[model samples]
Target: MIAYVGDFGLARFLSDVPQTSLVGVKGSTGYIALEYAMGAKASTQGDVYSYGILLLEMIPGKGPTDDMFKDNLSLRHFAKLSLPKRVMDIVDPVLLEEAKVSQGSGNHTNTRKRMHACLISMVRIGVLCSANSPRDRMEMKDVVTEMHAIKDLYLGVRIHQDEQVMSQLSGEDPSYLSYY
Candidate 1:
């Protein structure tokens, strides 16, 4: 890994490693896409799949090779099954708790909505980038655009509405807000 990093100056391999049994260059299992494993011609799609796996791993604080996964369960499969509805269960407990505490104490519906949107966007991006079919994966340019948008939201540069996050800390859900 160090050798590749030093060569490319990339923190990790974004280009596909040759599948030859010769010395040098070996791809890790689980992270490698089906095409790469099948010894097909390499493309940026393979890297997108790997990046998707990496992003998916961050949400649950688990790896593609985690022992808890059994049978047909993979990190991608787990993420696919636990989105939007049960996402809270899959997210790291500390992050989930922090979201709840922020929403609860801040008592701001806009902030809560923004947080949900941010998480959903992230999970959706990961899933899209890591789709089994290369055709289904997002292009690197699109990924960069989405990532910038996410960063903007994360930095509190609100995109949708100009409403400020309420400063008062309380437990009450605002009465006027009706989310449907």
Candidate 2:
């Protein structure tokens, strides 16, 4: 499969031929969807599962094959178990530190809250997309839409923060707060 980044910064892959079953499995071990191992054909659903793994990896900065994923634990389960709570524990330390620094500059309670929500939503999408059953996984289009929504929320908060900083620097009225 050939992969390229789409306009939304999402990776899109193209397969030259239609779906078909091969004699044997071929793909990175951690990324190959479970169905393929069970003699299922190459499919969009498999691709979605791999994409989900990719998304999950982004949160904790750990690959599926990481040493920590031995035994019953896996990247998917690790992320899924932390959802809606314990996000900070699973999130990358660098990101948490960066958030702390950003929160120090101003009244960042709103910023912190928005960021937390975005993180939870992202982990949820990853978990949904990587469900064990292909039928349970989200479609690629829906994943893209949900991702865009999260991106918008994140960027909105960032933009507001930037404007607030600018206003403080320029001694302008705090009118930008009204827009958010």
Name the top TM-score candidate: 2
Model 2 bad stretches (over 4 Å): 1-25, 98-106, 157-180
Q: What is the C-alpha lDDT of each candidate?
A: 0.62, 0.68
- Candidate 2 is scored at a TM of 0.71
lDDT tens digits by residue: candidate 2, 39-80: 666668878888888888888888888899989999998987
TM-score of each: 0.69, 0.71
Q: Tens digit of lDDT per residue, candidate 1, span 90-138?
A: 8887776766765565536666656655665677678887888888888
Q: Where is the poorest 10-residue window by lDDT in model 2? A: 1-10
